[model samples]
Target: MLHATGSKKELTRLAYYALVSDILEHADVQALKQFRHHRYTTRFQHSLNVSYYNYLLCRFFHWDAVSAARAGLLHDLYFYETNAYDRTESPGQKSHSAHHPEVAVQNAVDRFALNPLERDMIEKHMWPVTHRMPQYKESYAITFVDKYAAIVEFFGLGAQRMLSHIRRKQTV
Candidate 1:
């Protein structure tokens, strides 16, 4: 587990904040267009949503914020668009639900000179419940945060639909 030890916590937090700020400042407008809801959400929005949820999770766990933030930001880099995972998935691929973590790891490797910890977190983000279980604390943190974000996004959409149905019933 990447326990928050000594000054590492402060250093990592600074780095995490800086990275997130940098990413957001340089965020592509086209990428923002990709952000959408489950019913009508875009991939960019989903990534941002994951990021926000990951931030919350990091605070909860007192983790290395830099690792968690990076993992959250890049977790869905492969999706390109919303529902892309579902549209062209192979039947034999274990879980369409959890395929993005490894892809995200690859993206990180290609895009950044990540340390072993960062790479491990991205690669192992979908463990236990995934094809393979997470091996470290940072990895487990990513996995938990990813799952947490997805669940919130899922239920958030479902709740919106449920409320819409209720409103329709009242109108009828």
Candidate 2:
């Protein structure tokens, strides 16, 4: 069982690290650090943030934290360089937003013994963009958190940045 004590942000960080420790140790999961997600964030860092938020939400709502954490961590597991998609001769090549979810799902499935909910969370995270709605609460949680993390990463304003900002404010 995980314990939460401290500021909300600190508690969430603790829960996230506790929940995702196992997944992070997987060789396949570790490879995510090699891929860039958006702006200054690596796929591993973005996924960690998503997984952390999912875990925090699910824990608060009494949902399945395990599934949410695992699926969220694996949600962007499509290992190809995203830039490569642009090099195709034709426009029909697997575009990141339209196609990477399916690819990520397959990769997650191949390596992990995922439950249906976990699989669905990984498969349908892109939602209306991918035309697949989440079939479970955990799926929805992961989907929402994934987008939130992406926005934070895209702007290079995630927890680390927030912390830096906070410290600078305190010193002023």
Q: Estimate each model's TM-score.
A: 0.69, 0.78
Taking the tens digit of each residue's C-alpha lDDT, what string does model 2 give over 86-131? 5663766645776888998899888878899889998888887888
C-alpha local distance difference test of each model: 0.60, 0.78
Q: Which portions of model 2 show Cα errors greater than 4 Å?
A: 1-18, 158-172
Native-vs-model 2 lDDT? 0.78
For candidate 1, write residues 49-83 as lDDT tens digits. Answer: 55555665676778766666666666665636535
Off by over 4 Å in 1: 1-17, 25-37, 80-91
True-vs-predicted CA distance for residue 108, candidate 2, Å: 0.9
Best by TM-score: 2
